[model samples]
Target: MPVLSRFALLMLFCLSLVLVGGNSNELRAESRPNVLFIAVDDLRPELGCYGASHIQSPHIDQLAASGLLFNRAYCQQAVCSPSRTSLMTGLRPDSTKVYDLDTHFRKTVPDVVTLTQQFMKHGYKSIGMGKIYHGSLNDKASWDAYPTVRGRGYQLPETLAGIRERTKGLDVKKMNWRQRSKLTRGPATEMADVPDKQYRDGAIAEQAIKSLRELKQNQQPFFLAVGFLKPHLPFVAPQKYWDLYDRRQIKLAENRFPPENAPKFALTNWGELRNYSDMPAKGDLTDEQQLQLRHGYYACVSFTDANIGKVLDELQRLELDENTIVILWGDHGWKLGEHNGWCKHTNFENDTRVPLIIRAPGMQAQGKTSEALVEFVDIYPTLCDLAGLPLPAHLEGTSFKPLLSNPQRPWKPAAFSQYPRGRVMGYSMKTDRYRYTEWQDRKSGKVVDRELYDHRQDGAENDNIAGQPDQKRVVKQLSAQLKKNWKGAVVPD
Candidate 1:
């Protein structure tokens, strides 16, 4: 054998070793961070972080202070199913064809890959515990483990679950005329003297905390979505939470009526609030009743915040915070007697705008506030980008990774939201200082009504300027923008 041949063989062996070592290093550096996705139902921006200093939201405030809070975040629709469908699928409500609560997205687009399934495809274990989807529509295919979001939303003891049991019997038809006439109406707000675990949300928090502790032992990365059903209907919580707020100090809604000159169908029927047994059969709530409702909502918020704090505290205790990405988002805003409306289902600012906070590791965008216009759909691509996963081509939203590092980056000029009422669909666009909407007939696709609210002066959208002659030009411009190319298909320009 020649010495030159032996030396060549040795060099070849060294090159192979270097290649394997480099590949190993690359894989180690590219390990995706775990995701802690927390969702709150019907949460408005009435938090200390969102400039509501009087609200008791210390937990959410601290989370915002540790992350990048989007000042202008809008949901595709103001309702639960539609909004959650759009956010989870990375598609607009129109695209998903989920304009209402009854219809599932699969009925329209069966092959759609949801945000959770996207991560799961890349070897991550996805676990959904609460109201991540609307009702019992949680896609079983989208998770390694998905507990139905309704019945066991919490595992409260038999005693604490008594109030919920009563609500189950709210069907008026089931009661005889005598039963109905003799029915006793309880207040919409209830401060039960029960332990935290007595309510469903408290039970959800317990399960999530347990998950965090167990996840530390798993080798695979995780995407845990914990949904908190609070400040929602019934406004029920533990008595301790109700004690957190003073009913006297709670402020009633300023604009208790719909905006002046607004379209007739602009507000919902407020049927959700009306369905409660304590609510009167007709007319606006009394001043005292309004205050009680507001106080109940605040107490529910405080209860939710405390639960979130407990889960987040557990994460830190388990040392998961360092390598995990935490995202807190509300399904959509709620109008608590604002504009004479109760539940969400309108394009109004109080109904459409939502709270979104993302805290990525490495502290790139930590403790910052970004006023950039963003939408719920952006969560899909942004998570993909952060985790170094491939973005699906069908996603309608653009990744907001750039803005995560520099909050003032050039982002989307505006965010869009829409809601459906009967045969009419209201298309809304939110820009720097304006919220413009156009309601079109679903059958003919013809514009029926237009509304423009100048947020510069009235952020609460107290007045509709769309009908004013002086603001006609502004309305026209925004209308044109709304009807412009929405990713390819025109919204009937």
Candidate 2:
């Protein structure tokens, strides 16, 4: 066969090796960073990283170590649907008119591009898990492909186990006139018995890992969002996490009642129904029950932390951490007896304030905090800027890339929030030192309620200084600013 045949074969082998090496390098060079967006439902900044004494969120704290932690971040609306819709679409609730669960955003912004859609348009495989949208029905069309195993959500603990059997005898619809109610706590025996090996949070994290693994093999850019349904309601979690908190040692609010100078217009009826149903007018909940509920809330937070830890671990394991961007946010804050409110349906800080953290490779500021006034709408432009995409023309939010790059930069004078309706219509202008709100009855053109608080002076916002003669000028100034920013649209109550 001779030397000539052998030399030809050697040259062919060498060419194949060179081509393979070049292709591998090309894959590495073209690899766009992955994105992991985590959204929590009804979670306040109650974690070790956020300076909370009761909750444990080490995983999130570590993630913050690699990213930017927003100190004064807020949601557009306090409720789930409107808040989430505004954030996802990069539009205000008034602009989109998505005030309730019944309103689909497609109706408002039919041709509008969603964050997921924008990512997809830019060649990223956008995937949504759990409650990305307000409802489960519309999730499929929004995401590139919604997986049944990883994308679906679960019911709360009340429906998770034998509690379902216990609750069968009790009807949420028919149970009436109960002055107060309580949920008993015990070992989380159902954790092992749940059909899926993964808990709801665990399932989401695991699927995120799986998606990353698939991207690793295909060499494609990915945008994966994991939505954790925790610290929300019924406060159910594994018993081990419950054991972490001492119920007897829990601290109640110092100002349990309304403030001395609280204005009538500053009044809110948000949690009245929950108060009538489950909260006792006088000594309704036992000491044990109160502690147990607090324990459950914290436990759920820890459980969520563990799930976030899992996804972070996977990102590192896949060697995608350096090139990936991570964002964690909550739809809104929940009121656990704060201001006598159990849920978010008001314009107060307790109901509207949420946690928002972003971790971007090469762009992240390690252990930095930004107090810049930001809205949920701003998330739209922020993500677009991060991905090197053009901002949408219709977005009302201003991009904060400059501030993100430099945390100490000056920002807007105040963060604006609205609750638009006839009499409930109000505007909340929150600055570093004050939160001013004016409630008006639209029909009669009458000032129904006015509120002003020096946040530094009253962090909890228990006192109202709106009507004080000394503060009248300040109120008028804020009123003028409110009129300037009013979007002139009605949001359904």
Candidate 3:
């Protein structure tokens, strides 16, 4: 053949290969699902799907019905920053060196890719607002674009008259927003008769709705995260939400005192609660106070639920639900007088466990419930699997896609949680039937105290029976497992 004829044949062959490869890549991109992530702050599993029928959380219940709900999900640590950092980076608190609220994860793992950053890297438009990380704390490099002032989860304003009444002898009413935030608040609960947009969570929902609509018109797939603040501090909500429940019918925590044999440091003395003016600094809360506070929490939760519904409704209205994967989660659980603890600072079941629900576009186990033990750290790898992206080797969690497909599959042996008190670090591992905790000395790396709560008999974690002579063998097995799982250098003096 002539030279010109041979060259034309070779060019045709190369062109065919390029066309085939391009078509294959297009198919893979179309298969990738958009993500709609919702985070609620300080929420426990006291919802309609979790069997608390009295609670008015219809929005979350509808979400639960459309997905598989993990009955036992725990955060790496119960507090805000540590738990959020662990989930966002797929690292345990010890690994991230972010056990406290003040430290950022980048300080220890500066080059680590966050969950949102990984998605953004793969041609997704990632946007976030509200309480994704701890309030006023965020990963700047993660999102394509977010709000300048990530709004506080809740911001129901007190009337000037009300503020004056609360601060009769003071000039606090004249203070600016920054100055007022530093002032001591009077009530631990607020029932303001305001609209949803009047609060920060509601405004976040509005921004998220707008993003959803705009992203649908764009070519790139999107990751939209909307974090709701509610049922958290001050327990503020719209008065309509507060009216949903009768205060007389609300139930107080079954156990109001610390567990028997609980270590001195194991039980938090309700310090977070005492910061409020109305809450007592020394003695116990009155019966009326306890029930009233519980009512406020329930109301705020309902308020948050309603806002979530708004965002979900907008997604459907935009016809994006068919290709979107929805994941609703809380940072960690909260304690409403459980084991005499008012907030999440200890390794108790009430603080460590959280509510996690995931709904994929064509999921097999829709509306099912799973009792598998899973950790917050597992979320990063799971999203990667769902997005069909390459899993990073440095991640410390297992992909839970199998659980979404098979709710009863054999899963991890246990979920882990940790918290630090002044000089001690409590390492806790939650197995199928027990929570084993060992408080180690920060400097010496020696075990200072141990606690074992058997979920079978005491699901409320009402007692610590580690010292009981009868359960010595059980304690030994759990302690051995904790040592093997936690591979971290002990922080020193």
Candidate 4:
């Protein structure tokens, strides 16, 4: 053959390769599934799938069986604002400078796209209902179209009309010794009868089902975020849920009575205990009352589970289950009297560890469990990867694609969380088996709280063996890692 003919043949071969690669890319993009983003507030890993002995969460368990359940997932911050901010923006709490409930991540990453924004940019219709973000005051702009009437999963029926009023009468400011004593212990009320249609959980379910139905008819894919507000404080639920679990069956948590094994300074940062009038503070709530409160919490969880079931049922009914990616994540873990703490704020597992489940259509293997150390910040990149969307340049989290596909795949060795004050030296660190926190008192030098726990032995974090001679080596190694991996060292303006 002549040289010219040989060159022509080479060009043709190269062109064919290019066409094949391009076609493959198109196929992957076309096959990407719609995302059903489910966010729950203040939930711990108390689901049946996560091996909770008592609490019933059949809906979530079923979802987990059909998806990937992350066992050792940690939030960037053990509070709502920072956790949600990090999750939404794919930035760490320190990097975003959103350390409190009052501060939003917008100040740091003003032009940054949220998970919803990214999905919308890629031709997906984004809709959010209920408590997706941390909203104590109001977030009118958070959703695309927040209904004038409370969206589903956020209302109480007329039958329980006085529930809100009862919640309002709870006073936290009266933390005087007498008040704490008077409030401790006793049964308040049974789950009692309440109209199902009027409850917030039911409302959220109705709205989500409606949205799923509408989305099924549309040609465009959607990113529908259904947020459930429950298992949080003032754990109120329809009486039916409360009756499901007998109070005697409620198992006592390791450290439920009050603040123990915690520094006084650490306890001071717990504003929720002081702020939420409906919640019990230290020395308040007798053992029986504590049980009642806990009963309410568990019942609310079941109530939330039922609501989730409704949305899921709609997805199947609409035949959208095959093409949708479902993800259920709690903003952060709540402290149900763990480590002598009552709520999330500390870096303890009960506070920082949240429940994260992802079902990526046919991409994920059913009934898989991943123990990979993942952070809430990783949510952004994982979703982008699943959708074949380019991850924004500013995202700080790595996609857990490998781990999601194969649950036993090894990944990050540690997770990070941060807590900052307006002017204090603040606190931040990397955590694994050891929790290394550095607290700075404006006027004083940095004080380090290095707690080392053999998770194999101390899953409850009952003992803080920070200064133990035998654990010094482990603490030193973790300290070095903490400094090396500290992503949010500088405070954002």
Candidate 5:
């Protein structure tokens, strides 16, 4: 054995050790679980998992089976921008100052980091497509790859022609989105004999599937946010989904009248639905129309469910399911003729309660349902805790990560929600047995209207007993608790 031969062999061994060290670093980075954040617009807790036997939500039901389903989850606001802003920023509507669709959260909190942005700061590749933010108000800085992919709302040529005819003389370019929407809106529901890709939700799912493949190739942990637009408005879905339900079997809301002895200001005109061509301008929806709308909503839910199944299938095929934290949440809830309302402008149970299903890797609470009162604002901190990241300083909500391990554990005492009605703000607090709302004047801060619905007696919220003589004590207690707001409602360590 020569001395020079031994020196050459030693040098090769040292170089090989350096290469293994670099590879180990890469492997450590990839060890972090990926996120599949799915957002569905205008979805309520009306599915098989939620005890709605009629709705066909197989894919969502499957996701519920694999995750801890929050049965009592409520959104901060019952609208798109505000609810999403609150959830993404981990701040309430008051903190973000985003109460309407037109106002962007960045306008008020310019330096605040969003949910995905927090993950991005921690070496996660954030990618978003479709309606993550409301309409065109997406934050480009939050996503490494953010693309807008949407198709026509109406697939029928006749519907398009009708819209053009309705807006023929008006200058659409000069109008804002709401004004343009009112003028050009067609029928409330459409069932087209087209493929799933023909609709925007289907296209979004396809893009998500493709993105999952690309992320797998890169071998980097990603935060993929896919938003689905359906069961929202103009309830247009593929013909096959519509065929899944029989119109005769579709039942309208049993309590179609307004809540007894409730304030007039508490109910919305539901102008959002009246803008549709088929809807009446100033009248109650006909029984036939109500049934049709319910049927349309169910079909759209099924359609969105199928699209979700596609993405989930792709994730499993890529073997990313085991290492991905899959979360499906609706931006807010929608009312289908509940309390004689058609939209989500009121702070009722139907409008504020949303569907939230989260399936994380190695969670022991599989197929469990938690009745814990959770709000959308808690989502940001929960994801952070689940991924082993520190909670942001600006987070106004507590993490519910503990509930994933012990689904039946006693959690937050109450969940808070709010809705703005002109100059009034209706702040609602839902405890285990009751929902109390105080409609206060925004400028003067005077509590003008009050509502108290006892869930033990009236689960449908068909009666308001705020002014009842026997319920005085109940109202007083709930009012005191409402004053505590989100801060006092935070879960204990």
Candidate 6:
């Protein structure tokens, strides 16, 4: 062979060896399992799997069937920012010091490592989409790539016009998004004729699918967090989702009045719903209006369920289902006219209880339900435990990884949640039999009001029997447990 030609062939062989070596390294990184973390906004435990046959949530029900569904999961706080902050930071609301929507978790705990950030530190490619961290308060360091797609909250032209008319002479540019939204709000419900992709949740699903396909090509295990916004305020969804429910068949909440003998602060004014253009500011909704709101909420849920199905289908299509840990959770539960409340603000069962499902690869608890008490704060450590990563010392939650296998095993004694109303804080503890709450004055730390509902009888929370003569012993025991708080409730390792 000619000398120049021999040299060229030798150079090409060297380049091929380097390419093969790089590919091998990528394949090694793929040994760890991928994570598909799903977050849904304002979703309660209202679904077919949860025995709410009236709701058309086939996709969520299917997820529950495949995963281990928690029958009694609760959130740290029944609001967006605080609950999400607690879940992501593995801390309670009091620890995080974030009670309202405006305050960011990082403001209090700036150096804390979030759930996604912990995954990122372990060589997993973390990506977040949609409403993951409650509106625009995102942790930039937690993700490798976090892209956002903006869309109108309402779809119809009439709704857009109504908003414009409502805020005609106001300077919207000077107002923040929340303030502007309040001033230029449309009807509480909208059923528009549009494709699924036209909405934000639908668009988020498409983005997630695309990311999954791209991640399939890359050998790194990914932590893809997709958050869907739906079943929330000003319920807006495609007309087809609305068609899934017959309005006449939808019934109003059975217990529409406040709890008997309960403190006034325990009930909410549902100011979130009242801000809508069509809602009444200070009175009970008309029967027709209540039905419409229920119908809209159900439609929004079904719409979100369909979007979730699309993402899950894509994951299965890419053959990632076998090695991926899929977790679906709601940030917090919402009230559907229970106890004369329409939003999540109080520490009531309707507002605190959320739907949680976890489908880990090769888990023994597949297609099973766990009645164990779990809290949102436990999510951070549980994921860490599943990934074989060391738990952060700052984490305040217990890992319920053992329950994934033996779900019937004994777990935490109670799930704790709290809500702040002005100067008072209502701390609630939910055990197997009852939910007990104490409204304490923040300034002096004095128990001003108390609430207790025996779930065995008053599941709807129609009556507060805290002051009853016969339940003194029960209240005293629960009060002692409440004082113990989460630290006392944590299960042994």
Maximum-lDDT candidate: 5
Candidate 4 residue lDDT tens string, 1-493? 9999999999987775554343322223345578899989888998899998698899999999888899888888888878888898888876777777677666666777888887666667878877777764234344465543253333334423543444356774566534542343222323546665566667877888888888888887788888787776556677889888998888667565333344444443344554444444554545675677678888988988988998999899899998888999998888665554566776666777889999886665678888778888888988888777767888888888777667776577777775554344334443445555555554664563444556666667666666678877876777777767666222112
Model 5: how far residue 254 lies from native, Å: 0.5
lDDT of 5 at 155: 93
Q: Record all residue pairs in model 2 with backbone atoms less than 3 Å apart, i.e. clashing.
A: 265-449
**Can you list the residue pairs that collide in candidate 1?**
none
What are the models' TM-scores?
0.88, 0.82, 0.89, 0.83, 0.93, 0.92
Give the alpha carbon lDDT tens digit for every residue of 1-493 in model 1.
8999999998987775564342322222236789999999999988989998768899899999899999999899998999999999999988999987678899998999999998887778999887899865778888898654322222335523554466465875676544442333334677777788768888888889988888889988899999999988778888888887777777888889889889976887885677566787688889988888888888889999999999999999998898888999999999888998788889999888999999988868889999888889889988877876777888998777787889887767688999888999899999888999899999999999988988889888988889889997888788777888344221111
lDDT measured at residue 155 in model 2 versus the true structure, 0 to 100: 36
Better of 1 and 3 by TM-score: 3
In candidate 6, stretches whose alpha carbon ends up further than 4 angstroms from where it belongs are 1-29, 167-173
- Report residue 407 deviation for candidate 4 (angstroms): 1.2
Instruction: Provide the overall lDDT of each model, using Cα atoms, as 2-decimal numbers.
Output: 0.83, 0.70, 0.84, 0.71, 0.89, 0.88
Our model 4 lands, by Cα RMSD against the true structure, at 6.6
In candidate 5, the residue pairs with backbone N, CA or C atoms under 3 Å apart (3 or more residues apart, or in different chains) clash, namely: none
Tell how far residue 206 is off in model 3, in angstroms. Answer: 1.2
Ranking, lDDT, top scorer first = 5, 6, 3, 1, 4, 2
**Model 3: which residue pairs collide?**
none
**TM-score: model 4 vs. ground truth:** 0.83
- Candidate 3 vs candidate 4, lDDT winner: 3
Q: Superpose all Cα atoms of candidate 3 onto the true structure and report the RMSD in Å to 1 decimal.
A: 5.3
Error of 4 at 59 (Å): 0.7
Alpha-carbon shift of residue 114 in model 2 (angstroms): 1.2
Residue 55's lDDT within candidate 4 is 87
Q: Mark the regions of model 3 whose C-alpha exceeds 4 Å error after superposition.
A: 1-27, 148-184, 487-493
Report how far off residue 107 is in candidate 1 (Å): 1.1
